[model samples]
Target: MCRWTRQDRQRSHPLNIQRDEYARRRRQLMRMAGEDAVLLVAAAPERIRNADATWPYRQDSDMHYLCGFPEPDSVLALLPGRKHGEVVLFCRERDPEHERWHGESIGTERAVELHGMDDAFPIDDIDDILPGMIEGRGRVYCHFGSEPEFDARLLGWMRRLRQLRGGGVVPKEFVALGHLLHDLRLYKSRGELKLMHASANIAAEAHLAAMRMATVGRHEYEVEAELMRTMRSRGAVAAFPPIVAGGVNACTMHYQANRAPLRDGDLLLVDAGAELDCYASDISRTFPINGRYNREQRALYELVLEAQLAAIDEVRPGRAFDAAHQMAVRVIAEGLCALGLLAGTADDVIADGSYKRFYPVKTGHWLGLDVHDVGDYRVDGEPRMLEPGMVVTVEPGIYIPPNDTTVAERWRGIGIRIEDDVAVTRSGNDVLTANVPKDAGEIEAWLKRGMS
Candidate 1:
């Protein structure tokens, strides 16, 4: 077991996910894959932004989930019944020249020691070595089509194996890795939950800062800057590009160009989260730009908040994954109908799907290593049951397009969403991002304290 020590804490980031935990996950996955299979996981390719510039490298979530190795040009292999080694890693060799530009590469020997791999080799030698390991496997598991180059190489290895004289049995079947792997990822471990809570706390502070700085005449990006600064200062990064939409801009669900200026009486909707140690936290909050919501904004905002609360209540164990969405839709439909935004009763609005005009997206998604993390929402054509250790976001919103002209003008162009990270528990659920205020009155009071 890789135990965390005071020295380790001083030398590195506080979130110390033990090596044994990763090993346990690998063992669990291998057990599921069975002894006759060979599993291969490829690292994420670094992407280029423009000339000579590259976007920040993010490790493949699947690869990172298995081992905490943080380098590209790496491959993880699992041969369950292999006597020589069950876990293998092929990674970049140490190069002083490359180290001068980039950072040090954890060479093969260090990789074996640090990540507890049974064997390690240079990535450049994979083609020469890996095919021999794959020659006898009955089934091969990998993320098919994710990386064309990797897939092509894998296919080439298999073809060569088939042609070789007196070679051992080549893999007869190729399996999609996600179906098995993603299910494991859906359930969070203790370490993962800790990291997620930390991520949510960092994001909560950022959202609070955005609310405090959201005054009239401030540009959307300015508030976004505050969010970025807060997350970065806490040694975290944005889980996704921050969405700081103001007024009618909020009507657009995926609004990204946050350049609009804040105006008095218009609601500012900030949808953002922080990524800490690869675990992501997503939260969305809509507040008045001038520390006070107008009548229309207050009505929509309160309705969204009510819907979010109702949805969060359905996040307990045994509930279906979509239980929150159903509750949220019910509440939002009733509220909208009462507000005269829709002509029919709440039941009719839901049954006819008319409520989708305002509430387009789902109530939430599974939150973990990726913001919109892995795992199938359905199993056997039915909604999957919510289990303990499953983390989800309860985000309910209402977006009324500005030009609808279908109802009163006061209700148009007002967009409101209240979102929080919720973790299902044995008893009920825990709201990870509860540090931030969601109630309209609480938001006004929070802003007032900051202004004072």
Candidate 2:
């Protein structure tokens, strides 16, 4: 039975986002204002994947951060430095015609009650009501260059305000709200950490299920099906298109053409994630299709695993954001030299950029609401230091192409990636997805246990 039904979704617990959080964020925005600053954030619209087929609806990250409301066609307005300076949500009204085709629509009253907004109004009245909301505001803070439609609407709003400038009503400045919100989202709250941990657990279970279900002669899509099924069964959704690559295809990053059949001697890379309550957990694991790694595959897998472990160890509060990447690069360089993939010494190979031949991508990236979550790692042209409550992925891989003649035939067509979600802490790093097996021996044991 599917655990992610509409009923289950409705019964889900409300996130514990206090009203003070929104008040605090608004205060911070108001502090940046030269005069009256009004911030506007819009919710994401449901996109159509094809004719009459719509993609799963997910709330905008900024909107979710402010109100925790998941409904579509919603807009949040914040008039900072005012007596009533709080959130006001503009949302869809209940209509039987649209409600019959789509699911239920939470009207403005319910939106205000459920989301703790100061006030609410029907979305259809946005054109008539928004100008009044912006009449006395001196600065209009919104996400510019984000949505062309919204940009046009903003221009029209400003034009309307300009037309009424004879009445002494016009915004003096326009600023991008993304700058402020992005900085705020860099640090996770306790509630966010709880949701992120839940997401990581779901991803871990799904990956383990895929590992156990894998076997020789099975198609890559079959493994993907198992992963999706496991995730859905656990009341979660995929964060992104799961990558199930086998043999030579594993070397292709972002490989989604999961149509190839698994070969007995080939390696399989599954880069998948589970989204729980809109929080994302990204993890990648590579193992043999037949449940036992050969000599060359084991060597490369161990190397990548070693590099990943070293990178994870470097994750700590106050460390530079690039410290883990540098650590992983050093480990990869040393491993490549040991495997004879590079000719020179470790330092020389790293200095000459020979490491890129094997490790092309970065070691990892920040993980959260989006698969590659938002946050500026560098501020003022310097690396931003890691802080507690920040979640990130540590993924390291070595891909040896099938056509590369520099290596032996047995070593070709092997790609291995080991990924896990890590949360930086004052004490150390917490491996959120540690429940999933990664060690080569444990993976083999899991396969054996499944067969038994």
Candidate 3:
């Protein structure tokens, strides 16, 4: 059987992301901020899942972007034109007992060597050390309000610096880190695209597994479990909670109970993705629980598929960011009118916002470190233009609520969505998650092939 073998896992988890990549990113951001500003980024704090157990620790995206350090109780400081060192890191010191309980941490010395940092120190001395480093800077750039405790500590340091007139200088302004950082993150580097492609391929495998296992009499959670097994075996985790909605349950956009039993003649919508090495890939596919779509289900599924393809075609360099969404909406609106679900013309339906009853959300969003990744959809009060290296999700869905009386009885309670991760290239675009079949006929054939 084709599965995620040990060799396959090793091949997918490559050493493409090197210290040089992180160093390059740091240098670029520092040059953008200039010599007058100091940038501070903190690692994500560990959260309690319940009484004593802690949830899995994930590093902050900005921190990961700046330096590929993966640890809690860590802080990064980028001081432009510093005489001693331009890049500094404060992280947990080596502790034998702590390492025994948890895991070995990237101590100061290792952090500097492995992550290309100029200097590293124990995090406990941040209060005594960091303020001195920041004293002379004119502006402090940090992602404030994200971690209130860290924000308070930063403010306290500034307050302390103000009190000490002998201190060299105090920053006069505080800037949101996202202003300069997010834009840098939007463009995927060669290393990032490699990881994202691996991520998408892993998720596609899991979706195929789910499709094969989702037979009538199977519970939704069972299908979800299969997806988890497939992704986890590949050293990846779900980007978000897998949405395994069947039949009428699919009408709710974010239905995540994942406990419903599969029924024959019902369409199953599975919106799930996998995160590989912190890079994410999102894909959504609707197929038949019994391995074949009926007449009514196939009709709507084809419409959603058409919309998704039309939207994906618009993901090209120099194209408007919203162009894909507009095309998808137009296609769906026309399809709904043809099916007698809407009364007016496609243009009139869109202009009057009458099509929202069936399709409420936008076509898609940015996809990366976070499932719904960063990067502004609009800039200067207008939709931004698509650029090479930008990755987006082209998802177009139609949901008909079970109780809505406007639709025919057969059409009601049917929901369909087709999503794929597309990366804009210099030539045109590439579908990262195309391994999983999206066409109705292809889906039926794939399901008939059984487990891989």
Model 2, span 1-452: residue lDDT tens: 65453623543656545556756666676577534778898888788999989888898888877777788888888876456636688899989899798867778887767667778899888887788778887788899887788789888877776666476388888887877777778788887888888888888989988987788888999999999999999878999999999989998988989999988888889999998877899999998888788999898988888889999998998888888889989998998898788888999988999788788998888888888999987879998889998888999898888898987788887888999999988798899999988888988888888767
* Candidate 3 lDDT over residue span 99-143, tens digit each: 788866669997877778999999999998898889878999999
Better of 1 and 2 by lDDT: 1
What TM-score does structure 3 among the candidates reach?
Answer: 0.96
Model 3 backbone overlap count: 0
Candidate 1 C-alpha lDDT tens digits along 239-286: 999999999999998899999989988999999999987789999999
Off by over 4 Å in 2: 1-11, 14-35
Residue 106, candidate 2: Cα error in Å is 1.0
TM-score of each: 0.97, 0.95, 0.96
The count of residue-pair clashes in candidate 1 stands at 0
Query: Which 10-residue window in model 1 sums to the lowest lDDT?
Result: 5-14
Query: What's the CA error at residue 316 for candidate 2, in Å?
Result: 0.3
Tell me how far the alpha carbon of residue 131 in candidate 3 is from the true structure, in angstroms, after superposition: 0.6
